[model samples]
Target: EAGVVQSPRYKIIEKKQPVAFWCNPISGHNTLYWYRQNLGQGPELLIRYENEEAVDDSQLPKDRFSAERLKGVDSTLKIQPAELGDSAVYLCASSQLGAGGYNEQFFGPGTRLTVL
Candidate 1:
Protein backbone atom coordinates (compact mmCIF):
# COMPACT_ATOMS: atom_id res chain seq x y z
CA GLU A 1 0.00 0.00 0.00
CA ALA A 2 1.39 3.36 -0.98
CA GLY A 3 1.08 6.43 1.20
CA VAL A 4 1.57 10.18 0.94
CA VAL A 5 5.18 11.33 0.90
CA GLN A 6 6.50 14.62 2.25
CA SER A 7 9.99 16.04 2.58
CA PRO A 8 12.00 17.79 5.25
CA ARG A 9 10.11 16.57 8.27
CA TYR A 10 11.31 19.63 10.15
CA LYS A 11 12.70 22.99 9.19
CA ILE A 12 14.08 26.01 11.00
CA ILE A 13 14.47 29.28 9.21
CA GLU A 14 15.01 32.89 10.06
CA LYS A 15 12.31 35.43 9.54
CA LYS A 16 12.07 36.72 5.97
CA GLN A 17 13.61 33.55 4.52
CA PRO A 18 11.90 31.64 1.77
CA VAL A 19 10.79 28.07 2.37
CA ALA A 20 9.12 25.35 0.40
CA PHE A 21 7.47 22.00 1.12
CA TRP A 22 6.76 19.15 -1.26
CA CYS A 23 4.24 16.33 -1.22
CA ASN A 24 3.37 13.32 -3.33
CA PRO A 25 -0.05 11.87 -2.72
CA ILE A 26 -1.18 8.30 -3.16
CA SER A 27 -1.54 7.17 -6.72
CA GLY A 28 -5.00 7.61 -8.30
CA HIS A 29 -6.22 10.06 -5.69
CA ASN A 30 -7.85 12.92 -7.56
CA THR A 31 -7.99 15.56 -4.88
CA LEU A 32 -4.90 17.11 -3.31
CA TYR A 33 -4.83 19.49 -0.37
CA TRP A 34 -2.68 21.70 1.85
CA TYR A 35 -3.36 22.86 5.36
CA ARG A 36 -1.77 24.76 8.21
CA GLN A 37 -1.98 23.55 11.81
CA ASN A 38 -1.26 26.21 14.34
CA LEU A 39 -0.25 25.30 17.86
CA GLY A 40 -3.14 24.01 19.92
CA GLN A 41 -5.58 24.39 17.06
CA GLY A 42 -7.12 22.17 14.44
CA PRO A 43 -5.74 22.22 10.94
CA GLU A 44 -7.03 24.97 8.72
CA LEU A 45 -7.49 24.52 5.01
CA LEU A 46 -5.12 26.55 2.94
CA ILE A 47 -5.76 25.27 -0.52
CA ARG A 48 -7.35 22.39 -2.37
CA TYR A 49 -6.92 21.01 -5.89
CA GLU A 50 -9.04 18.80 -8.03
CA ASN A 51 -7.24 17.23 -10.96
CA GLU A 52 -4.78 20.05 -11.45
CA GLU A 53 -7.33 22.77 -11.00
CA ALA A 54 -7.26 24.82 -7.80
CA VAL A 55 -10.86 24.50 -6.73
CA ASP A 56 -10.54 26.45 -3.49
CA ASP A 57 -7.85 28.67 -2.07
CA SER A 58 -9.69 31.38 -0.23
CA GLN A 59 -7.81 30.87 3.03
CA LEU A 60 -4.38 31.06 1.51
CA PRO A 61 -2.48 34.27 1.96
CA LYS A 62 -1.75 35.30 -1.61
CA ASP A 63 0.88 37.84 -0.74
CA ARG A 64 3.34 35.29 0.68
CA PHE A 65 1.96 31.81 0.21
CA SER A 66 1.41 29.87 -3.00
CA ALA A 67 0.64 26.31 -4.02
CA GLU A 68 0.34 24.20 -7.16
CA ARG A 69 -0.70 20.68 -8.03
CA LEU A 70 0.60 20.17 -11.53
CA LYS A 71 -0.97 17.24 -13.36
CA GLY A 72 -2.76 16.60 -10.09
CA VAL A 73 -0.21 14.03 -8.89
CA ASP A 74 2.32 15.98 -6.89
CA SER A 75 1.98 19.29 -5.08
CA THR A 76 4.14 21.97 -3.59
CA LEU A 77 3.54 24.77 -1.10
CA LYS A 78 5.83 27.71 -0.71
CA ILE A 79 6.12 30.58 1.70
CA GLN A 80 8.22 33.54 0.72
CA PRO A 81 9.80 35.63 3.43
CA ALA A 82 8.35 33.55 6.20
CA GLU A 83 7.19 35.23 9.36
CA LEU A 84 7.14 34.18 12.98
CA GLY A 85 3.39 33.86 12.84
CA ASP A 86 3.79 31.41 9.98
CA SER A 87 5.42 28.78 12.11
CA ALA A 88 3.25 25.71 12.15
CA VAL A 89 2.83 22.20 10.84
CA TYR A 90 2.04 22.23 7.16
CA LEU A 91 -0.11 19.24 6.31
CA CYS A 92 -0.58 17.46 2.99
CA ALA A 93 -3.61 15.34 2.29
CA SER A 94 -5.33 13.56 -0.62
CA SER A 95 -8.51 11.69 -1.22
CA GLN A 96 -10.66 10.00 -3.83
CA LEU A 97 -14.38 10.23 -4.22
CA GLY A 98 -15.93 7.15 -2.72
CA ALA A 99 -19.35 5.67 -2.31
CA GLY A 100 -22.05 7.86 -0.74
CA GLY A 101 -20.44 10.96 -2.17
CA TYR A 102 -17.81 11.17 0.53
CA ASN A 103 -14.10 11.66 0.17
CA GLU A 104 -11.86 9.88 2.65
CA GLN A 105 -8.71 11.86 3.11
CA PHE A 106 -5.30 10.37 3.90
CA PHE A 107 -2.87 12.62 5.65
CA GLY A 108 0.91 12.65 5.69
CA PRO A 109 3.20 13.47 8.55
CA GLY A 110 3.31 17.23 8.23
CA THR A 111 6.41 19.29 7.70
CA ARG A 112 7.01 21.32 10.82
CA LEU A 113 8.21 24.80 10.04
CA THR A 114 9.68 27.14 12.63
CA VAL A 115 10.35 30.71 11.73
CA LEU A 116 12.51 32.70 14.11
Candidate 2:
Protein backbone atom coordinates (compact mmCIF):
# COMPACT_ATOMS: atom_id res chain seq x y z
CA GLU A 1 0.00 0.00 0.00
CA ALA A 2 1.80 3.03 -1.24
CA GLY A 3 -0.37 6.04 -0.60
CA VAL A 4 -2.38 7.14 -3.63
CA VAL A 5 -3.16 4.23 -5.85
CA GLN A 6 -6.72 3.68 -6.98
CA SER A 7 -8.20 0.81 -8.87
CA PRO A 8 -11.41 -1.23 -9.03
CA ARG A 9 -12.09 -0.37 -5.39
CA TYR A 10 -15.65 -0.29 -6.71
CA LYS A 11 -17.31 0.32 -10.01
CA ILE A 12 -20.64 -0.39 -11.65
CA ILE A 13 -21.48 1.16 -14.96
CA GLU A 14 -24.64 1.44 -17.05
CA LYS A 15 -25.50 4.99 -18.04
CA LYS A 16 -23.48 6.00 -21.07
CA GLN A 17 -21.08 3.12 -20.56
CA PRO A 18 -17.38 3.91 -20.49
CA VAL A 19 -15.17 4.09 -17.46
CA ALA A 20 -11.50 4.06 -16.66
CA PHE A 21 -9.53 5.04 -13.60
CA TRP A 22 -6.05 4.32 -12.37
CA CYS A 23 -3.41 6.04 -10.34
CA ASN A 24 -0.14 5.54 -8.49
CA PRO A 25 1.65 7.97 -6.26
CA ILE A 26 3.67 8.29 -3.09
CA SER A 27 7.12 7.37 -4.24
CA GLY A 28 8.80 10.73 -4.39
CA HIS A 29 5.54 12.62 -4.16
CA ASN A 30 6.01 15.32 -6.73
CA THR A 31 2.45 16.50 -6.31
CA LEU A 32 -0.54 14.68 -7.74
CA TYR A 33 -4.26 14.79 -7.23
CA TRP A 34 -7.55 13.83 -8.79
CA TYR A 35 -10.52 14.38 -6.57
CA ARG A 36 -14.25 14.13 -7.04
CA GLN A 37 -16.07 13.20 -3.86
CA ASN A 38 -19.71 14.14 -4.24
CA LEU A 39 -21.39 12.02 -1.60
CA GLY A 40 -20.94 14.41 1.29
CA GLN A 41 -18.95 16.82 -0.82
CA GLY A 42 -15.37 17.80 -0.02
CA PRO A 43 -12.81 16.57 -2.50
CA GLU A 44 -13.12 18.60 -5.67
CA LEU A 45 -9.92 19.60 -7.48
CA LEU A 46 -10.40 17.33 -10.46
CA ILE A 47 -6.75 17.32 -11.45
CA ARG A 48 -3.32 18.51 -10.42
CA TYR A 49 0.09 17.08 -11.19
CA GLU A 50 3.61 18.38 -11.39
CA ASN A 51 5.97 15.55 -12.13
CA GLU A 52 4.67 14.73 -15.58
CA GLU A 53 3.29 18.23 -15.77
CA ALA A 54 -0.46 18.52 -15.71
CA VAL A 55 0.08 21.75 -13.85
CA ASP A 56 -3.49 22.21 -12.64
CA ASP A 57 -6.39 20.86 -14.63
CA SER A 58 -8.45 23.85 -13.53
CA GLN A 59 -11.40 21.82 -12.35
CA LEU A 60 -11.08 19.50 -15.36
CA PRO A 61 -14.17 18.90 -17.46
CA LYS A 62 -13.13 18.70 -21.05
CA ASP A 63 -16.44 17.57 -22.50
CA ARG A 64 -16.73 14.07 -20.98
CA PHE A 65 -13.65 14.28 -18.80
CA SER A 66 -10.20 12.80 -19.39
CA ALA A 67 -6.77 12.77 -17.77
CA GLU A 68 -3.33 11.31 -17.99
CA ARG A 69 0.24 11.45 -16.72
CA LEU A 70 2.40 9.41 -19.07
CA LYS A 71 5.85 9.88 -17.53
CA GLY A 72 4.59 11.59 -14.42
CA VAL A 73 4.95 8.26 -12.63
CA ASP A 74 1.40 6.92 -12.96
CA SER A 75 -2.04 8.42 -13.50
CA THR A 76 -5.10 7.81 -15.56
CA LEU A 77 -8.66 9.08 -15.39
CA LYS A 78 -11.30 8.91 -18.01
CA ILE A 79 -15.07 8.93 -18.43
CA GLN A 80 -15.93 8.81 -22.04
CA PRO A 81 -19.70 8.25 -21.82
CA ALA A 82 -20.57 7.61 -18.21
CA GLU A 83 -23.25 10.03 -17.09
CA LEU A 84 -25.78 9.60 -14.29
CA GLY A 85 -24.07 12.49 -12.59
CA ASP A 86 -20.92 10.37 -12.79
CA SER A 87 -21.61 9.00 -9.35
CA ALA A 88 -18.91 10.05 -6.92
CA VAL A 89 -15.86 9.24 -4.79
CA TYR A 90 -12.96 8.81 -7.18
CA LEU A 91 -10.29 10.31 -5.06
CA CYS A 92 -6.52 9.86 -5.70
CA ALA A 93 -4.41 12.22 -3.73
CA SER A 94 -0.67 12.72 -3.34
CA SER A 95 1.32 15.68 -2.19
CA GLN A 96 4.82 16.82 -1.44
CA LEU A 97 4.34 20.44 -2.34
CA GLY A 98 1.38 21.67 -4.29
CA ALA A 99 -1.24 24.36 -3.92
CA GLY A 100 0.80 25.74 -1.06
CA GLY A 101 2.79 22.55 -0.75
CA TYR A 102 3.67 20.85 2.50
CA ASN A 103 2.61 17.26 1.97
CA GLU A 104 -0.55 16.24 3.81
CA GLN A 105 -2.52 14.40 1.19
CA PHE A 106 -2.85 10.68 1.52
CA PHE A 107 -6.23 9.35 0.51
CA GLY A 108 -7.38 6.43 -1.51
CA PRO A 109 -10.05 3.87 -0.69
CA GLY A 110 -12.14 5.29 -3.48
CA THR A 111 -13.54 4.34 -6.86
CA ARG A 112 -17.05 3.57 -5.69
CA LEU A 113 -18.55 4.05 -9.11
CA THR A 114 -22.21 3.17 -9.51
CA VAL A 115 -23.96 4.68 -12.47
CA LEU A 116 -27.23 3.27 -13.53
Candidate 3:
Protein backbone atom coordinates (compact mmCIF):
# COMPACT_ATOMS: atom_id res chain seq x y z
CA GLU A 1 0.00 0.00 0.00
CA ALA A 2 3.00 2.17 0.05
CA GLY A 3 3.94 4.53 -2.75
CA VAL A 4 7.37 4.58 -4.30
CA VAL A 5 10.26 4.82 -1.84
CA GLN A 6 13.63 6.45 -2.50
CA SER A 7 16.71 6.78 -0.37
CA PRO A 8 19.09 9.66 0.21
CA ARG A 9 16.60 12.40 -0.53
CA TYR A 10 19.54 14.62 -1.34
CA LYS A 11 23.08 14.09 -2.50
CA ILE A 12 26.06 16.35 -3.09
CA ILE A 13 29.27 15.47 -4.84
CA GLU A 14 32.16 16.97 -6.74
CA LYS A 15 32.16 16.75 -10.49
CA LYS A 16 33.50 13.47 -11.91
CA GLN A 17 32.39 11.48 -8.87
CA PRO A 18 29.98 8.61 -9.07
CA VAL A 19 26.46 8.72 -7.68
CA ALA A 20 23.70 6.19 -7.25
CA PHE A 21 20.01 6.28 -6.44
CA TRP A 22 17.66 3.61 -5.17
CA CYS A 23 13.94 3.05 -5.52
CA ASN A 24 11.30 0.63 -4.23
CA PRO A 25 8.02 0.63 -6.06
CA ILE A 26 4.62 0.09 -4.62
CA SER A 27 3.58 -3.50 -3.95
CA GLY A 28 1.77 -5.22 -6.83
CA HIS A 29 2.95 -2.64 -9.28
CA ASN A 30 4.27 -4.10 -12.50
CA THR A 31 5.69 -0.95 -14.02
CA LEU A 32 8.50 1.19 -12.68
CA TYR A 33 10.18 4.25 -14.09
CA TRP A 34 13.13 6.56 -13.48
CA TYR A 35 13.10 10.18 -14.55
CA ARG A 36 15.37 13.17 -14.43
CA GLN A 37 14.23 16.76 -14.18
CA ASN A 38 16.42 19.75 -14.73
CA LEU A 39 15.58 23.04 -13.14
CA GLY A 40 12.42 24.56 -14.62
CA GLN A 41 11.96 21.60 -16.96
CA GLY A 42 9.56 18.72 -16.85
CA PRO A 43 10.79 15.30 -15.90
CA GLU A 44 12.32 13.31 -18.71
CA LEU A 45 11.96 9.57 -18.68
CA LEU A 46 15.37 8.01 -18.30
CA ILE A 47 14.20 4.42 -18.14
CA ARG A 48 11.08 2.40 -17.81
CA TYR A 49 10.75 -1.18 -16.64
CA GLU A 50 7.97 -3.66 -16.99
CA ASN A 51 8.60 -6.03 -14.16
CA GLU A 52 12.19 -7.18 -14.70
CA GLU A 53 12.53 -6.03 -18.27
CA ALA A 54 13.71 -2.60 -19.24
CA VAL A 55 11.15 -1.65 -21.85
CA ASP A 56 12.41 1.84 -22.64
CA ASP A 57 15.72 3.50 -22.03
CA SER A 58 16.47 5.61 -25.05
CA GLN A 59 16.97 8.69 -22.96
CA LEU A 60 19.38 7.07 -20.58
CA PRO A 61 23.04 7.88 -21.07
CA LYS A 62 24.68 4.55 -21.59
CA ASP A 63 28.27 5.73 -21.36
CA ARG A 64 28.03 6.92 -17.79
CA PHE A 65 24.60 5.83 -16.59
CA SER A 66 23.22 2.40 -15.80
CA ALA A 67 20.13 1.02 -14.15
CA GLU A 68 18.68 -2.30 -13.11
CA ARG A 69 15.55 -3.73 -11.61
CA LEU A 70 16.48 -6.91 -9.84
CA LYS A 71 13.71 -9.41 -9.00
CA GLY A 72 11.30 -6.89 -10.55
CA VAL A 73 10.57 -5.03 -7.36
CA ASP A 74 13.42 -2.72 -6.52
CA SER A 75 15.61 -0.67 -8.83
CA THR A 76 18.82 1.29 -8.84
CA LEU A 77 20.21 4.07 -11.02
CA LYS A 78 23.83 4.96 -11.20
CA ILE A 79 25.77 7.74 -12.84
CA GLN A 80 29.50 7.27 -12.94
CA PRO A 81 31.81 10.23 -13.11
CA ALA A 82 28.97 12.58 -12.53
CA GLU A 83 29.03 15.81 -14.42
CA LEU A 84 27.98 19.28 -13.39
CA GLY A 85 25.24 19.10 -15.98
CA ASP A 86 23.90 16.03 -14.23
CA SER A 87 22.79 18.11 -11.30
CA ALA A 88 19.05 17.66 -11.07
CA VAL A 89 16.28 15.84 -9.30
CA TYR A 90 15.91 12.11 -9.91
CA LEU A 91 12.37 10.82 -9.57
CA CYS A 92 11.03 7.30 -9.29
CA ALA A 93 7.49 6.34 -10.15
CA SER A 94 5.36 3.21 -10.39
CA SER A 95 1.98 2.10 -11.56
CA GLN A 96 -0.09 -1.02 -11.95
CA LEU A 97 -0.68 -1.99 -15.54
CA GLY A 98 -4.37 -2.30 -15.99
CA ALA A 99 -6.60 -3.39 -18.81
CA GLY A 100 -5.66 -1.79 -22.11
CA GLY A 101 -2.38 -0.58 -20.60
CA TYR A 102 -4.08 2.03 -18.49
CA ASN A 103 -2.32 3.00 -15.32
CA GLU A 104 -1.89 5.98 -13.01
CA GLN A 105 1.55 6.67 -11.73
CA PHE A 106 2.58 7.42 -8.20
CA PHE A 107 5.77 9.30 -7.63
CA GLY A 108 8.20 9.43 -4.78
CA PRO A 109 9.96 12.39 -3.26
CA GLY A 110 12.79 12.85 -5.72
CA THR A 111 16.49 12.69 -4.89
CA ARG A 112 18.12 16.05 -5.44
CA LEU A 113 21.62 15.56 -6.77
CA THR A 114 23.98 18.49 -6.71
CA VAL A 115 27.22 18.26 -8.63
CA LEU A 116 29.76 20.72 -7.39
How do the predictions measure up, each by TM-score?
A: 0.94, 0.32, 0.95
Cα lDDT tens digits, model 3, 29-105, are 98999999999999999999999989889999999999999999999999999999999999999998642147788
The residue pairs in collision within model 3 are none
RMSD of each: 2.0, 11.6, 1.8
Query: lDDT by residue for model 1 over 1-116, one digit each (tens)?
Result: 88999988999999999999999999999888899999999999998888888888999999999998887799999999899999999999899943213778899999999999
lDDT of 2 by residue, 4-65 (tens): 77898999989998899898888888778898989877878888888888888878888999
Candidate 2 clash pair list: 98-101
- In model 1, the worst 10-residue window by lDDT is 96-105
The lDDT ranking, best first, is 3, 1, 2
Q: How close is candidate 1 to the true structure, as a TM-score?
A: 0.94
lDDT of 2: 0.85
- lDDT minimum window of 10 residues, candidate 2: 94-103
